[model samples]
Target chain A: MKTAQKNPPAHSVHSVHKTPTNPPDILAPVREMIQACIQCGTCTGSCPNAFAMDISPRGMWRMVIMGEDESITEELFNTKTFSLCSSCYTCTLRCPRGLPLTDAIQALKRIQTRHYPEKAKKNIHFYASFLESVRRHGRVRETEFMTLFFLSMKNPFLPFSFAPLAIRLMAKGKVKPGFPSAGNGALDPIFQKARELEASS
Target chain B: MKNFTHRYFYYPGCSLEGTAKEYDISTRSLMAALEIELTDIPDWNCCGASAAAAQGELLSLALPALNLAKAEAAAQASKSTAAWDILSPCSACYLNLKRAEAETARNPALRARVNAVLAEKDLQYKGGVQSRHLLDVLAKDIGASRVGHAVTNPLSGLQVAPYYGCQCLRPYAVFDDPEIPGTMNPLIRAAGAHVFPWNLSARCCGAAHMNTHPEVGISLVTDILKAAKGADLLVTVCPMCQINLEAYQNRASRLAEEDLHISVLYLPQLLGLAAGIAEEKLGLALNLAAEKDFRFETINEPI
Candidate 1:
């Protein structure tokens, strides 16, 4: 009888170091996380918005584990999955392998936001609006931020859907406009420094 | 009625000022009624919520670190005779501060980076502080028996489904089982209220997505309301969950094709009701669905 063929090492295929142009190092932080993914479809199954995502959590894992950074970012930039995450962390807790899926997704968001802002327009603009609000006043002014977000994301009508609730809130003496000058002196510089560090790093 | 007393440094995140004002009002009223003294950390800023972390890891760590630094300074300035635990009514603030504390402790490199950024503002984050959800404080620290004894106005008539949205129970929910949290159950029962159990208690309520993707958020909330089938109302810990569940009720009712008539109450608002605080003081009018479904009376508010 012929001897049975032995299985090769898991990383044997991806072991060769690719150049920086491939964005391999961009995902260096979650390299181990990607590899540890058993592809059990546990994450995809747990994700509430899996049906809406262009690339399911399972698909992201498969590509990332194989070091397919191009495909990963393409789907990330093209899809609204990360923004839909909500940081609920249900998948992280449910993962049998305990992969930090939430962090990995956030990492993907950070990379795309920093390097490819144009492609990641919807989510990136949302993040920018939030940061701008905080950076401007040391605290987020929700109405300002929401308005700016919708306008910047080119989805101004989005806020109109919830306008009735906003009206109710306004009537109830909630929805306080004009942010009090709380963190102006203390937090503005810190925010500027953070932006500087984020850009440099 | 028994007076359960404790001291906590309060961190009312930005949401308290705008969207979830009633949560803040109810938290204050409930804590005051419990004889729990709360010291607001002066010069507190945003916890960065979901936005900062998504932008940069350093920014995420740094933003909450600034709050911690401020909390530390306040505690030291007051020299208060209480354990310096920072109490955050906002689950997002609690999680962010807790995560900042953990990150600064574990990653020295990140801590150094954060401190360097903080140094510019004359702030420093020396990690050892504990960030606690007010619910955890009420349930674990104060104990259910005390809360039970303090219930002058038992919520016997009200059926409340305790909802633990992501922050207070996930990533690092130490008080109870993250999967099937029991912290709120005993407390809910302490107030003589019944719990409508369902798997979605610890599930995501499609949080900030209510703004970005309202459709998805509405659908998720519709599922929650569906799960909360026979309950009189859905009671929650996080502001975002409360707003999502409350604000989208009409839309959800239409979408689900079922007359989903349950109201959403902040846990504190429900507790305040049980404590006999006046409905106005508890800001009961602000809860959208609750205003529609239940009528509140000016209960016996003892001076």
Candidate 2:
């Protein structure tokens, strides 16, 4: 029932400059997938976290399909609508257009990270810390990953917010205390090759 | 001598080693009791989870591709001509692996790109390995009747709610009805527990949002917990759902202004108990809510 804001906030990330008229190449697949959207609003209706989103899923799609002014796309990116998606795929399942709505939302997140890392700073730090853990160790060590994330945030107070849960989990032996190590380093070659490929492409 | 009926390459993702260790323990114990042989995918790495997608589609695909390629190589090395199945207990890991399998199978261009990255590790995923969730294998491959036959202690009188969460069901409706998943219903019944009717089975548990955005995550958890108030325990197939539902009860209670305390357990842990595998083996003590909120004695009757 929440309504989308018509205009971007004055202090929004891209308020200084208009976004490019054409969407990024990364969004081409998503654009093709959603071009058939009839704006039935089924995605918005089925979304569990739509209330938390600034713009409804339907509204985001409408902007993409309409390919209107640069400001509209700027407003679309400015909103945390795609980031709020839980990847539940409910919206994708219910979309009458059979569009990959969830994947499109995820692509929005990728686009945010690729084109606007400054705007997606917090999300970038969070996911980077997680993947860094995986890259270092063959698997993610939760404590190590959380510590890296907290350190990356540079927010000294942030650790306290999660301290109670961490303490409880540690006390229950759910999480073991350990320093991060070069766990087998088996995945290093793959990660190196992937980075090389991505950079080249 | 026990005759093993089925063999699979087990991929216990990162969470299974830490927060959701109990899930791994219970699953291994339960599967062993059912005469299922699980071989760990040799040198398997992280699935990149929901995070890697932010880096790039290639990294996300490549991360799981490494695991899938490893499984395929392991299968070939063992000289097993039959196709291999990589069984992931964590829903996130299953989804990532399955996505890699499905994407690479249909898109040869993508397959080449992913295999190009895999060539670094001297691995090439040929797309024969099947990525499966434990629920899918249990519901379809190992039917409820077989599970029932293994139960030494019936979980009679226990009211249980099956929580499918997301990932496993959506966008892939592989085995069960995505919206109204009944795959776990027969499994729950097989353990001799009454299926507590609830509509929030396929609902989202907010996944990693609990860490990134606690307010949104706690609100969703509160709603799901509120809906599951009547059930004695909520059973989940996803490690993320299990942790989010079990870990945030106090916060969810405060947010909702109600004492929302429900024992949330992995489905395998529940079945492990019914199969009369020792509670210690099932890692029951590791569960945050199970110790304080759930009582095993209430349903500890031999059928």
Candidate 3:
């Protein structure tokens, strides 16, 4: 089940104007790499997420080669299959045409994140919030990252769903209730550096 | 051109400089005895691990490009008449460099932007250096035939998971298969250790995710540990993956409500053990596992 973001907008794949005539610089090499694909079904056939893909690896390759990037981009970013991609090189290793499929898809994700920085920003916020806890504490305190993630979300109780598990963890001595460590030097700079890097380009 | 025994350009990321000093230490000591020389990059910078990409996409590529540029310059300065093999002991560093090289090589425009960033430091990368992880260099350069001859101890009966992690194989299919990578397995076996064949061998240990999202990180580590439950030890080739899974294994195991206490050792450490290097000499003391628990004894029988 795909979970919708708090404030939703109704937009379909057709809304975006994606053309191949002159794609972004970051995307050109990707396009060329995808064009090298001979539409061999080997990737789709071997893909662990082939059944789950919005556009199968072959279809994604075809769309990329045709310069129908919006469709490809939408499928990748909006669909669960993208993240489900194991970043495994099974497809690339199997490609007889020597196309770098694994690298191309990951590169595609990086490209999409570049254009729609906000979505990437949101994911980063959720992701980095955890790192902030670790950097501040020397070691990661699960309770802290969970607390921050939930607080940032409109539905605060969403994280509580995992409370029972957390309880079990605490009982097993996997996580300590109190501060795991008493250091904060590396944490601030790590987070600050990450944020600054994100904000720059 | 000056000739040096087994000399290659080295790229050590932030972890080696700070947290994973043991990986840096052991790698240097083990490689030195094997005649593999590590020449660190001058003015080397971060490889932009999991942070750079999350912060912004451009820096993800640019940061690695900076390291690669330094390596290329060093290679040129050395004037060594060998292929430019830029060896990265860290998995994240290796992946980032390979990813940037593959991306820029594919897109000249992106290369231009990256070059613009490189211009700031007055360095230009000509795509000369081949970004290879230390594991690849061990297997490809020093073949199994050579490694077999070097083995002094065989880690027999010890079942180990050859955890490739994500960075070594992702983006660029440089060395091994991402899903079922066994590129390092044969190498381990050559040293006489039993390679534990498992599905999660190439699974993500959340890399930097453990630092950013503890829940996700814990969940990922739990799953990886669960998958690799049968193994005696989890041998890894990446520094970040090593730290996350090994350092955080107990915590992740506790979080998942299990009594999982799998040892995590570096591939080089395992190789060092097989190569007759003592466990203490290989920095096994720094490991979270019982250092004495997994030592391999040399066998008189041919493996």
Contacts from the true interface found in each model, as a fraction, amount to 0.73, 0.82, 0.10
Q: Which pairs clash (backbone N, Cα, C closer than 3 Å) in model 3?
A: A29-B106, A103-B171, A130-B212, A131-B211, A131-B212, A135-A187, A136-A187, A198-B55
Candidate 3, after superposition: displacement of residue B284 in Å? Answer: 1.6
* Predicted candidate 2 versus true structure: per-residue lDDT over B1-303, tens digit per residue: 243344599999988988888999999999999888899998788999998987788999999998999998888889865557989999999999999999999999999999999998888999868899999999988889999999999989889999999999978889989899999999999999999998999999999889887889988999999999879899999889998998877777778887778788899999988999998899988887784436423321111
**Candidate with the greatest lDDT versus the true structure:** 2
Best by DockQ: 1
| Fraction of native Cα-Cα interface contacts (under 8 Å, chains A and B) also present in model 2 | 0.82
The deviation in Å at residue B152 for candidate 1 is 1.5
- Per-residue lDDT tens digits for candidate 3, residues B220-257, read 77778888887888888877677667655556656878
- Using all chains and alpha carbons, the TM-scores for the candidates as numbered come to 0.90, 0.91, 0.65
Error of 1 at B253 (Å): 1.0
Model 1 C-alpha lDDT per residue in residues A21-61, reported as the tens digit of each score: 66545666666656678889999898988767778888777
Using TM-score as the measure, the top candidate is: 2
Q: Residues A98-197, candidate 3: write the lDDT tens digits.
A: 7877667666656656675554554555645555555565334556666666666657656665565456445434445653344544334434443464
* Candidate 3 CAPRI assessment class: incorrect
* Cα lDDT for residue B18, candidate 1: 82
The candidate, 1 or 2, that scores higher on lDDT is 2
Ten-residue region with minimum lDDT total, candidate 2 chain A: A10-19
List-wise, what DockQ does each model earn? 0.52, 0.44, 0.11
